[model samples]
Target: MPVTPDRWNDLERLFGPRGACSGCWCMWYRIKRSEWSSNANAGNRRAFKQIVDSGGTPGLLAYVHDQPSGWVSVAPREDFSSLERSNVLKRVDDKPVWSIVCFFVSKEHRRQGLSQALLEAAVKYAAEHGATLVEGYPVDRLEGKKFSSVEAFPGSVASFRRAGFREAARRSPTRPIMRRRVRPRPKG
Candidate 1:
């Protein structure tokens, strides 16, 4: 479900005290390198909390039997500061798009199709929230190589393909910018 204020505790519980990846708190793309380096984990956690507290729906959390099991960061492209600066992920078109920047599945939930589910959920989230295009950066993989958990946060090309996102651009050998057009719900 959308990460609202009431759901903040659920998110915190899912991320744990370490803030999911040694203090990333899912803010790697939201803040600058200087601020991120100086503030680190605590700072990023606070920043993310503030976004939630202020009624910003930064992403969605997936639940398994009512237990928060996964997370996917999906918001407008403009919300990701780091993405705007990356040449490898530069915009492929002038059309506005929502970006999927991160995914975090609990250790127990890994390798169980949670990431693909999250991508589908993200597309629905973006469409319902007024986005017509949803984009993601996924690793296409190298011959006979596997991505460690940390290296796969943005998702895998296979997952994106399974989620119906096609490659829009591939600036790097492994990194492909994938996109899917979303049809918003009809208004009453």
Candidate 2:
């Protein structure tokens, strides 16, 4: 389900006290770096809550046995200011798109293909919201090399691939801009 006001506590529980990474509260891509650094924990939490309270569906939540187990931040490309400013993750074209910026799964839920499932749900969510194309910036994992979970927060290229996304651009060796076209839900 989308992260609405009533589901705030479930999201908080899923993210834990660290806000899913040093107080990110999933607001890292939504705000400027300096602001994110300053806000960190409590401020970020409140800021995110305001988004939810205002009825903005910043992302979707996944549940396991009725417990919130994962999150994926998907919104209009314009919603993430940091992406427009990133050297490696800059837009691929003028075409409008919805970007998948982050993913977090509870420790116990890791390696269970939850990330791939979340990506699929994100694409569906975006399509339902009138998106013709969905994009993701996933980290390309090298063979025989392991990276920390923090580094993999954006998600893996393989996961995106499994969700039917293809590489649209690759400015960085380890970061690939992936895209998937979605037919918007028919009007009622």
Tens-place lDDT per residue, model 2, 120-185, is: 889999999999999999999888889898999999988898889999999999999999999999
The lDDT of each candidate is 0.91, 0.93
lDDT for model 1 comes to 0.91
Model 2 poorest ten-residue lDDT run: 179-188
TM-score each candidate: 0.96, 0.97
Candidate 1 lDDT by residue in tens digits, 1-188 = 99999999999999998898878999998888788878788999999999999989899999999999999999999999888788999899889999999999999999998888999989988988889999999888899998898899899999998888999998999999999998986432
| TM-score attained by model 2 | 0.97
Alpha carbon lDDT of residue 67, candidate 1? 98
TM-score of 1: 0.96
Candidate 1 error regions (>4 Å): 186-188
Pull out the clashing pairs in model 2: none
**Native-to-model Cα distance after best TM-score fit, residue 93 in candidate 1, in Å:** 2.0
